[model samples]
Target: MVEIAAWLRARQAEGTLRELVDLDHLGHGRVRLADTEGPALLDFSSNDYLALSEHPALIAAATEALQRYGTGAGAARLMSGNFPVHQELERAVAALKGQEAALLFGSGYSANVGIIAALMGRDDVIFTDRLNHASIYDGCRLAGAGIARFRHNDLNHLEELLASQPVKGTRLIVVESVYSMDGDRAPLHELVALKERYGCLLMVDEAHATGVFGANGGGVIEEAGVASGVDLAMGTFGKALGSYGAYVAASRRMIDFLVNRARSFIFSTALPPAVAAASLAAVQLIQQEPGLRQELHQRVALFKGYLRQAGFAGDLGPSQIIPLRLGSSATAVAAAERLRAHGLFVPAVRPPTVPEGTARLRLSITRHLGEAELAAAAAALVACCLR
Candidate 1:
């Protein structure tokens, strides 16, 4: 006990330790129910971008699946738990993304780790964006690939780093289509050109872009018309899909390779049948309801407009996830508290999730929020900025 306590104390002394905040008092969206807090705050923080978290259709699908197949898969897909729901989801996701095949994982976090590590290894060279999701970074590390990080979204830096290397062994370039933190997008066209020039494979994490972009809601790869160009595209059902699962859309060969090689996929239990059913329903809904995307786009535009009109000071980008940069973690935390005090919920994203000195409030907008809600949240944000 003394030894463990000493180790924990060391981390706290170095300012790298974290203590999870109690969410018992939190409400939905960005507002959490803290024990010390009063009143329900307006939520602007949830990753449920489509507001499908509580959608009746999704809920019904999940309930049906649970009734039909029970709550758990009971085994890995390759083993006894290969349910019909999983097969249906794989096929549905493949068709939705216009890919040859799709493989399901427990979560986007595991999908990225499992797929990347399985595909690339010690001999591979993985070029990554600095702002890519931590799952990507971990995947690269797990693969034991030599990693080279370029500046965030800087193709020139990427090219320069690639050029400096005399031998490119199994080159893999990784990036997020829409960075989760800054809410900015990747230059897919330029990335395609670079990949073509270097003869490298590209892996895109569309976790944030799924259900938010594309004519059919496939994500940035489809939105940019690079679905066929990218070697692998991964996304999460947890976000806009309003469920819990992750998938990799790729060629049949790649899918098969992951099936045999990805340790996480092999060892972990398959996603619950209910979640898979709900995800399949979510996929169908995304395609059938183009209005959802349209409305979300309108909300994004409206939020940005409100910021511009109010002259709110922050890095408000094109994506739905807007970063209200406060520059310091302490200040960001304080501002979040201030917003919460006004019945507005916004979490302060501190270091590790974001780079140092760039701690901010990550505000995500969705179509579920009406114009009045948007305006009110924006006004509150602006007031917080002013303070």
Candidate 2:
């Protein structure tokens, strides 16, 4: 215990320790932190891209479910915890993603780690993008597979690694559709082609892209017209869909396999009925309401244009996520403070979340904010950078 205390103290001294701060979510892209009382700021750090978390339909669904099914899932899914809402949500998700079946998980992290661990083993070889979510890396490590990381979004490097290495028992390639920190998309088409050439399984995590892309919010896989090419497509309902839980959309056989083999899914209690109901509502709304997706894209364009006009140089790619690079942890924190002072709430992402010396403010655009709020946020960010 003393050694643990000393290590924690050392981390705090190095400015690497993290502590959670309470925040009051006032609707429409506004939040007030516990330290402050009166004014709520325009938040650019949220993953609620469509602002559906507080939608009336989702709220109503959750309320109805809570009244009907009580609070907790008493046991794991393999036991007596599986409810009607759970199956309904899975069916809806599978249809949305154009998959034959879908399996729900407690969270995106659980889905990633569970899927990888269930499929790969010590003899298998896993190739992952260097910038994939930490959950994917954790899964690889836990599986005890031979892991190789390719340069971020570099298909050439991936192919080189594949060519240099001999055929292993099972080769799995993992990547994210849109990187959470950088907001850049992976080359899914190229990756699919490579997977075909090498006869390896491909997995694409669409956590950041789902509910924001495609005609029906099926995500990048559907948008690219390569849904059939990829083997496993994983996504989360907590981001653009503005709900909780995660899922892996795959063929019927794959879903069945995961139901039996994935330890995380097998051991964890099922999501509460209310959460499943709310997520299902969110998914239905995302399909029915194309206007929300359109508005989000327009806002992203407007915000990016404003930043460019203000002399911002970083590219945010085609996604709604934008990063304001600040170089050092101290500078990023200071910049966040400046933004907060101007009634803007942006998080400063430091080392481990981002690469060393590339600490940045990750700004996520949502449809809740209109042009005026976006202008203010852009100006505040520009001022912080200039200062």
Candidate 3:
């Protein structure tokens, strides 16, 4: 207990102690701090890139399912909890990812960890990106396999590790299609070639890219024309889809194997029928409305252009996520406060969310915000962090 307290004190000294803030959503990219009737602040910290969470289509689907199916699934999926909406959503996900089959999990983190644990085992060696999500690392630990972590997005480094490790068991390589924090995309073509050369299974976590890329929102894999080369396509409905749950799209055999072997899926209750239905609606909506993705990119371009014009060239990527590293936790927190002072509520992302010296504010471009809001956010960022 003393050690725990000391650790917390250390975090406090570093200005990294975390706390949750209650917020009231005001729609159209505005939020107010709850309990005090605070002024509406431009919400630039949400992951709802396409802002479909509050769409009428999604809401109506969820409402219908709720009225028909009640509140919960009542049991684990392997038992009696599975609903028709589950299968329907899985089919939609499989089609979206261009795979023969798919299986749903409670969340993106669970899907990732469960997928890794079920596939690679004691004799296997998995090569993963150094900066891959924590769930991937947890999955590696659960699998009890030989783990090789290469530098983030460095194919040469990954190849070096792959070549050095002697061939043994089922070799797998995992990476995110679009990094959650950095927002940079993976080199799918090169990774596919390397996978072919090494005879390794390749998995791409398309959580961030799923609803924001490709003509039909199939993510970076489809955008790069390497969907067939990827062995497993993992993604979530919670982000741009604006619903809850995650899924993995793969061959029929692989998904069947997960159905039988993935412990997370086997042990957890199925997602509520309404959430699954909402997710299905979100998927169909994204496919039918390509304008949503296009409009989001236009917002990205507009915001990034503003930053460029303001002469702040730290870390601006093509995707919706952007970071402005401030090197100190206190500095990042101060920046967030300054932005909030200007009626923009971008959160300060400090360690351990980022590296020790890479603390910054993560700004997510969403369709909820209009051109006026985007311009105001850009101006605030420049005033808060740049100058």
Candidate 4:
């Protein structure tokens, strides 16, 4: 206990200690932090891109499911936890991604970790993007696979690494459709071609792209017209769909293999039937309403324009997740505090979420904010940074 206390003190001294900040209320793109007794601030730190968490349809479905199936799944999925709503949600996800089958996990982390560890082993080699989510890296390590990292979004570098495979057995390449931190997109078309040429299996993590890209929210692979080429695709409903849990959409055989082999899925209790029902309803809503995507993009564009007009320069990519680099963890935290003072809730993203000296403010855009609200938030951000 003393050693743990010392370790925590060391972390605090280095400005790396983290604490949980409760939100008294979270809705309508604002949150009332428990520590603050003031009104809710405009939230730019959320992952609710489509703002469907409070949507009537999702709420209704969850309510109905709760009344019918109760709250918990009671057992592991392989035992007695697999509910009809679970299978129904999987089918909806599979259909959305244009895959033959899909399997659910507790969250995106479990899905990535379980799938990678299940599919690859000591004899296999996995190539991943350097800027891929930490979950992906954890999965690679857990699998005991020889891992190689390519420069972020650099297909040429990826090819060079692929050509120089030192140990080769069941080569698999992993990348995200839209990188969460940087908000940039992967070159899916080029990656698909390269994977085919190199005879490597490809996995695309669409956690940030699902319900935010493609005509039917099928993500970047579908937008690139290479959905058929990618071998495995993983996504989370907790983000844009504004629900909980994750899924891996793949061929029927691959899904079946995971069902039998993935320890995370087999060992963990299944998602509550209410969550499954809510996620299914959210997916259905996303498919039915394409206008939500359009509106979200428009707000993003407007926010970016505001930032550019204010002479704040950083890589604001084409996607809704924007990162404003602040160079150091201390500076990023200070900036976040300043934003909070201005009634904005954009949190500072520090290492190991980002590399040292590359700390940032990860701003996520959602459709709930109107044009005026976006403009005001952008102006506040610019002012906070300038100060």
Candidate 5:
């Protein structure tokens, strides 16, 4: 116990230990809903890129589902809670992705963990992006596969790594369609070509791209025209769909194997029927409501254009996620504080979530922010940065 406390203290001293902040019951989008420290703020820290979290259509669906199915799933999926709504959503997801089958998970984290750990083993080699999400990294570790990293978005490095490594076993390449932190894109076609050349299985995490990328918001894979070639695709409903839970789109054989073997799926309580129902409604919206996706694309373009015009140069990837590099952790936190003071609520992303010396402000744009709100945010950020 003494050694553990000392280690924690050392970590803090080294600026490597994380400190959590109480967000104080905030709403989604660019507004902090509630707080004890000061006034309510306009939120820009949300991952709800489509602002569907509070959409009337989704809310209506959820409310109706609640009346029909109640709150909890009551048991694990393999047990009593294999709700019909779950099967409906899975089928909808599969059709939307043009896949043979889809399997649902309680969260994106679990889907990645269960899929990777179940599919790969000590006899496999996993080639992951250097900036892949923690969940993917954790999954690879848990799978006990030999791991190697290609530079972020660098297909050349990935190919070189694949060719140079003398490691044996099945090769798996993992990447995020749109990286969560950097708001950059992976070179999907080039990576897919590499996989074909090397005979490797490719997995894509569409957590941040779902509902904002593809024609039907199938995510980066669809946008890149490689949806058919992807071996496994992971997505979440909590972001653009304005609902909760996640699913994997893959072959029927893979789904069956996961249903029977993935410990995370079998051991955990199934997603509540209400959540599945709401997600089904959300998917229907994605299919039928072209206006929402259009509006979201416009929002992303407007924000990125504003950032570029402001000379706030950064990666500014082709997706909604944006990051403003502030260099030091203290500076990033201070910038968020300044934004909050100006009635904005952007979160400061620090170490552990990001690597050292790369702390910055993560700006998540949504369809909810009108022109006035965006202009105001731009002005506030300009003021803060200029100061």
Candidate 6:
């Protein structure tokens, strides 16, 4: 206990200790501190890119499923937890991702860990980005695979690492389409070509790109027209879809392989029927109402424009997730607090969420914010973040 206290004190002294801040959701992309009487803050911390979390259709689907199927999947998927809704949702996801089949997992963490571990072993080698999600690192560890981490989005470095590997060994390359903290996109087309050249399997994590990029909200792979070249397209409904679960779209054979060998999927209880239903409804809404994506991009542009107009010179990147790089953890935390005082709730991102010396505020834009809210948030951010 004393050791743990010392560790926590060390974190606190370094300005990296985290605390939970409870907020009351007031809807329309606004929230307020649960214990405070301050005005609602413009929410820029959510990943609900299309603002579909509160959509009526998703609500109706979840409500119906709950009333009919109960509140939980009472057993593991291999036992009695599997439902038609789960399978139906997988089908929809597979079709949307332009794949032959799909498999569902309880959460994105379990999905990534299980999928990667199931696909590789001690004899296999996995190449991933240095900035890949932590779950991927855990997965690689579980697999006991030889791991090579390339610099972020550096194709040349990736190829150099790939060329040094054994020709007969199983090789897999995994990366995220859009980086969560930096908001930069991976070059999927070039990545596909490199994988093909080296006879390696490619897996693209589209957790941030799904429901926001492709015409049918497929993901960056779809937009890049390289779906056929990639082996696994992994995504989560918890973010853009505003639901709780994750999936991998791949060949029928690969899905079957994971079904048999993926311990996380085989042993864990299936997702609640209502959760699957909600995801399905959200997917349908994304396809039917394309304007939501358009409006979101426009809002991003508008907010970025306001910042640039205010003489801010930070790189906001190409996606909805914007990082205002404030040099140190203390600086980033202070900027976030200042923004909070101005009615904006932006979290300060720090190591190991980001690398040391690269702390920033990770601002995620969603369609829920109106033009006026975007303008106000931008002005607040500039005033609080800039010198």
- For candidate 5, the per-residue lDDT at 153 reads 86
Off by over 4 Å in 5: 1-4, 7-20, 23-37, 313-315
RMSD of each: 2.3, 1.3, 1.1, 1.5, 2.0, 1.1
List lDDT for all candidates, in order: 0.86, 0.90, 0.91, 0.90, 0.84, 0.92
Tens digit of lDDT per residue, candidate 6, span 343-374? 88898999988899999999999988888888
Q: How well is each residue in 1-387 modelled by candidate 3, as lDDT tens digits?
A: 468989889989989999899999889888998997568999988999999999999999999999999989999999999899999998998998989999999999999889999999999999999778888889989999999999989999999998999898999999999988778888899999999999999999999999999989999988888889999999999999999999999999999999999999999999999999999999999999999999999989998988877777766977999988788999999999888779998888887777789888889989998887788778778877888
Q: Candidate 1, residue 221: CA error in Å?
A: 1.2
Please give the distance, in angstroms, between residue 294's alpha carbon in candidate 5 and its true position after superposition: 1.2
lDDT for each residue of candidate 2 in 1-387, tens digit (9 for 90 to 100): 479989889867765577786899889899998776758988898999999998999999999999998998889999999999999999998898888999999999999999999999988899999998999999999999999899998888999999887786899999999999999899889999999999999999999999999999999998998989989999998999888999999999999999999999999999999999999999899899988899999999999998878777767578999887878888888888888889988898888888899988889999888998898788778877754
> Which lDDT value does model 3 have at 139?
91
Candidate 3 global lDDT:
0.91
Residues 150-206, candidate 1, lDDT per residue (tens digit)? 999999999998888666468999999999988899999899899989888999899
The collision pairs in model 5 are 27-33, 30-42, 30-43, 30-44, 31-42, 31-43
Winner of 1 and 3 under lDDT: 3
lDDT tens per residue, model 5, 271-311: 98888888998898888887888997887788777766766
**Pick by lDDT: 1 or 4, better one:** 4
lDDT of 3 at 128: 92
Tell how far residue 99 is off in model 5, in angstroms: 1.1
**Candidate 3 — which residues are off by over 4 angstroms?**
none
Candidate 3 vs. true structure, TM-score:
0.98
Per lDDT, the best of the predicted structures is: 6
TM-score of 6: 0.98
TM-score-wise, the better of 5 and 6 is 6
lDDT of 1 at 252: 96
Instruction: Give candidate 4 regions above 4 Å deviation.
Output: none
